[model samples]
Target: MSIQDQEHTAEPSSSPADSAGTRRALRADLLRVGKIGGARSATSSAAVIEGHALIDRRTGVWVPLAERRRQAAAGSPADQARWDRLIEAVTRPTQPTEVSYEKLVVRVGSARDLLRTLADTLPPFVPVAEVAQRIEQRVESGTYPPGAVLAPGRIAADLGLPLQSVHLALSDLAGKGVIEQQANCRARVPGANPFNDRPRQLAQLLRALAAGGAFPPGTALPGRRELCRILVTGDKPFAAALRLLFQEGLLERDVRQRLTVRRGSVKRTDPPKLPAPAGHVKSLRDDEIPEAARRTRAWWNARLSPAPAALDQVIDQLGATAHQLVDRAQPGSVPPSTAQQQLSALVARTAITAAAVHHPHFELRLWHAACLATAVCDLLALLDDLDASRPSRRTAMPPLL
Candidate 1:
């Protein structure tokens, strides 16, 4: 056949339709393979979960709607609150997969949990001054009233402070006279609130009484406890006031335990009545000891250098000392000339020792020499007694040749 006739007679092969069908079949096969690969991967490796709850809520047996309705109908406020908590615990969302790895794997992420982990590494800060201030305020407020027992350990626990800090605070309070230590060593708030200026008040009153001739020389004063009651204060302030009187030669407790007024301690000034709110004035008196200064002026005054002795008396003391040294008056009764020579040697050694005190050498060579010299002097004196105790090795005295 001619070529044209063969081409025309050849049936159309339908290549377009065949190609379209093959392409569709290839796409469907690829999709099925991708699904199978995903399934295999999911089974082989586990996904990291960052949720607070490890077990899934849905894993539990499901409750029926009818039973839920019944529980709701029967629920009280407590039951309802409990149910709410359970619901919250179950429904609260957590970051299980906050980040992805190349769109295939997910990495679990932390939220507040990471911050909590770092909390342990941080240093703790304690508010020391604030705690002390709070405790002091409590004292002022009568939360710990006068004479009330205090437990340092219990207070430390309550205030979140170290036990040592609480102990130090107690000591500070005791030193301030805000508290007193008991026989048991436990601290108690003093019955006397000297912060109220009870000592100064008592001083003023006693001064007025002295001026009025109530306390003459050799007069017996009232008992301390009675004064404590009359003054509406405690023993601490009364004791302080009484002590000031004692120091000023205003009062003395005799061997009979009776308080005696000294001849002339009180100033004998005009007696003024105590102020209306009791002992304190609206404006504190200028003469009164300040509250901030816990100690009395007398307390400070007692610590002073004594008066120096007269020049003649000092010279007499030195001369007497010289004679005692020259005498060698002890168990050792050596001859006068021998003792004098030893003393002169000792004086020379001492002079050398004193001169070398600031020497560059760390060791004290000269001081050691002085010690040896002293030992020799003592040995020489001791030999005299030994010689007297024993029979002499000298030839028997030829009868008064």
Candidate 2:
């Protein structure tokens, strides 16, 4: 019967054939988006499917779709309590299952991959230095089509980057409001795209050097003004980029009126790191947190079952120690001995808290904490250097012979 006829007949419209057809359509749309370099969209499709599958199966959080669906269709709640955030995503969209094809097709990836890739490759941590250079290289190689604009076709060809990568980069740049998407869906290079400023200067300089054969390992470069016009920045950024290249050992300039590329140990500019996309727990509402955190706490509780009561005691002790440190810290006054003792106490508290928090997903947190520790150490080192440079309060107390 026709779709209209089947609807009118009302004999449980979602027959096996109908369900199979929907799945096929979803899969086909998925592949098409993937082939066009829209991996983010493809991932979204996967997320939608996994989400919907959870709802259809009526399973609890954390249960995989395959098992949840089996239980849901069977009208069993055996796996329902185990329903996870995946199930939430599936059922959360207000639209009925019948209209979810478009959205589902757009997002089709595992939750782990989405979270991990964003954590790994998203910017602020993922540097764009190399990416920008790669783009510059392509622009100079004449791989990009010559135009008044950075057309997508030319952009993809010039960089030898796939359309999807270009699309994503373009989207990123657009989000920053650097480039505007035109009426025809083309990207128009804004008059002052911030990412363009430094890159354009660097590109011009590289091109000038390439043309003049001054970029080879031992060739010297021209004077400041001669190179300055080729580069495009004001006094500060221009000088900064050049100084950066020098520091990286890429360019060696002498008082003699010229510069040359260093033979080895040349460092390239690194990119800015991107922030990780917000994750499941962070994405939840305030009211939803106690429940989710309780789940997480329960998992931890189970893992620590061997010494549950003991762990609780230790956590209490740690919290008590933290409170004492704060309470003892006097207002507007610091005795040198007290300050030193307080620093030691803070360190002890951090170690204790870390030990008590025992979580499988805490690696990223620890990595960041370690970075902060390194920065603190470096700052302390600088202070020591400064202190040593000055006269001691009592020179006689420091005679270490």
| Predicted candidate 2 versus true structure: per-residue lDDT over 272-350, tens digit per residue | 1112322321223324323433433333322212123443343333333333222333222223543443343333323
Q: 225-291, model 1: which lDDT tens digit per residue?
A: 7555333345887788887777777787778989877766655432222112322213222222122
> Which candidate gets the maximum TM-score versus the true structure?
1
Q: Model 1: runs farther than 4 Å from truth?
A: 1-201, 213-217, 267-401
Which residue pairs does candidate 1 place in steric collision? Answer: none
Query: Each prediction's TM-score against the native?
Result: 0.22, 0.20
* RMSD of candidates 1 onward, in order: 32.8, 23.1
Candidate 2 Cα deviation (angstroms), residue 61: 9.8
| Residue range with the least summed lDDT across 10 consecutive positions in model 2 | 392-401
How far in Å is the alpha carbon of 198 misplaced in model 1?
4.8
